[model samples]
Target: MSVEAIVNDVKTRADVVVTRGQEALEVGVKTLKTANGIVVEGVQELVQTNVSAGKELSTLVQASVTKAKTDGLKAVASNPVAYLPEGKATVLGAYSESLKIVSKTGDELAKTLKSGVETISAKIQGQAPVVAKARKTATKTVAKAKKATKKAASA
Candidate 1:
């Protein structure tokens, strides 16, 4: 089979694994939320901690990608089908590159989620008073906008 086909198969398998992990995490979070009053607060703290730890996870994954690349190349090379005719080497090379690409994609996703969480946490911390104030402000703004639109429609 082609390297692209092999990579697609690997990706499909990885996606299933990731989905299961997310589901397990969700269950844990839900269990914690229901178990104790303190768990709710603790879960929020956990989210903050996880966000901060994202960078570390990204770094670890990057290292893992190096290992995966080597292993993936080896697997491709060892496969009799991958060592077929003319473009076997090229296909194997592409397969190795695909592993790196998938790893990098995962790293990027972690970094993005970490950055977003950090930003949201910082904003929540920095604007505790302002958030409440903004809520009222938003309410009034929406009311006024609705009134104006209604009046324009009538006119």
Candidate 2:
């Protein structure tokens, strides 16, 4: 084959390689987006689970306290001498304390979830610009390399 024909063939192969590289880059970008979506979904599910667990715990506490109150009231009525007025149990106070504890725990979980989401979003945002800059730099470098190759082949 002639020199010009071989040079043209090599250039064609190089162009094909560059095109494939760009395609791979695009695929990577898509994968990144998919990964981000998955992460967000996972975090949301975790937050929901946390909320559900808090609610279940609160329900259990309320049920147990209600039963205890019923039993105590019976005891006080049956034995007035043993259950003095000064030593009388306050059901409302117990329930109020339980509610406060549950509320505090739920609030903490919510705050943690919010903090985690903000961190993940910030990191994802931070990586995008760097990836974009790298891709731009790579395209420029590839173009320069192709130009140099063509010049050398022609000479």
Candidate 3:
């Protein structure tokens, strides 16, 4: 083959590699942006749920404290001689109720977390095919570039 013909062949191969590389990069960027948006949306929803749950827990605690104080005062007024033991019992009962509230709150938080994780997992899984396509394009671009380089050097 003429030297000019070899040179032309090399230039054509280089152009094809460049075009394929650019296409792959565009696909990758688009995929990344979509994935990032999905993750941000998921995180925002999780945070909102947590904030509301925290507020509810705070309200419940405040109510529990108020009731415990009122009940303890009533017990002391009814029987002054047994005030110490009655006060202790009242305090213990309040603590037990508080513990139950805390346990329930914890369970709710766990459920929220589990649901959030599953939703995010499903969304990410949906993007798998797009990601794979981008990866395949990149791999093919690299292989073409390598083959072109080898041929150009030999020529």
Candidate 4:
């Protein structure tokens, strides 16, 4: 089955669950959205830390993707799906394929993220010392200007 079909099935299932209780549906959606937001923020922080640590960001991204795929598969398997008209084998096969695609995409993203992190780290590391020196020079220049101004005011 296509990814779209699997997603549609999940949506329908969630709707059915929601029909049982409005509060449950609202809570579930809110929790999922919050989790997604946290994940996005965590990824950004990981990228930034990789730049500072001079480490490859790809490893962190890859690990996260792998975990997400595993969690998704588990959720699909555990979810109640008796309402679907499809045979068990067909539904299971589709879910499995969907999981496989998610894993594959995650692996590719991990590689891309790692490469990007490495590049950013290298650039930052290369420029860090220069930036520090420039800041120090600027600080001294400012101090000198202030001293000159004070002397002039006194005279």
1 or 2, greater by lDDT: 2
Each model's lDDT comes to 0.46, 0.49, 0.49, 0.45
Instruction: List runs of model 1 lying over 4 Å from the truth.
Output: 1-84, 127-155
TM-score of each: 0.27, 0.37, 0.47, 0.27
Tell how far residue 82 is off in model 2, in angstroms.
Answer: 23
Q: How many angstroms is residue 121 displaced in model 2 relative to the true structure, after the best TM-score fit? A: 30
Candidate 3 vs. true structure, TM-score: 0.47
In the predicted model 3, the residue pairs found to clash are none
List residue ranges in candidate 3 displaced over 4 A: 73-155
Which parts of model 2 are misplaced by more than 4 Å?
Answer: 2-4, 69-155
Q: For residues 86-142, what per-residue lDDT tens digits would candidate 4 score against the true structure?
A: 334544554565565445434434443343344334343333222233333433433
Model 4, which residues run further than 4 Å from truth?
A: 1-86, 127-155
Instruction: Give per-residue lDDT, candidate 1, residue 103.
Output: 55
**Which pairs of residues have clashing backbones in candidate 4?**
58-114
Q: How far does residue 4 in candidate 2 sit from its true spot (Å)?
A: 4.4
TM-score of 4: 0.27
The residue-by-residue lDDT of candidate 2 on 79-109, one tens digit each, is 6555333211344444554565455445433
Model 3, position 88: C-alpha lDDT score: 46
Error of 1 at 55 (Å): 38
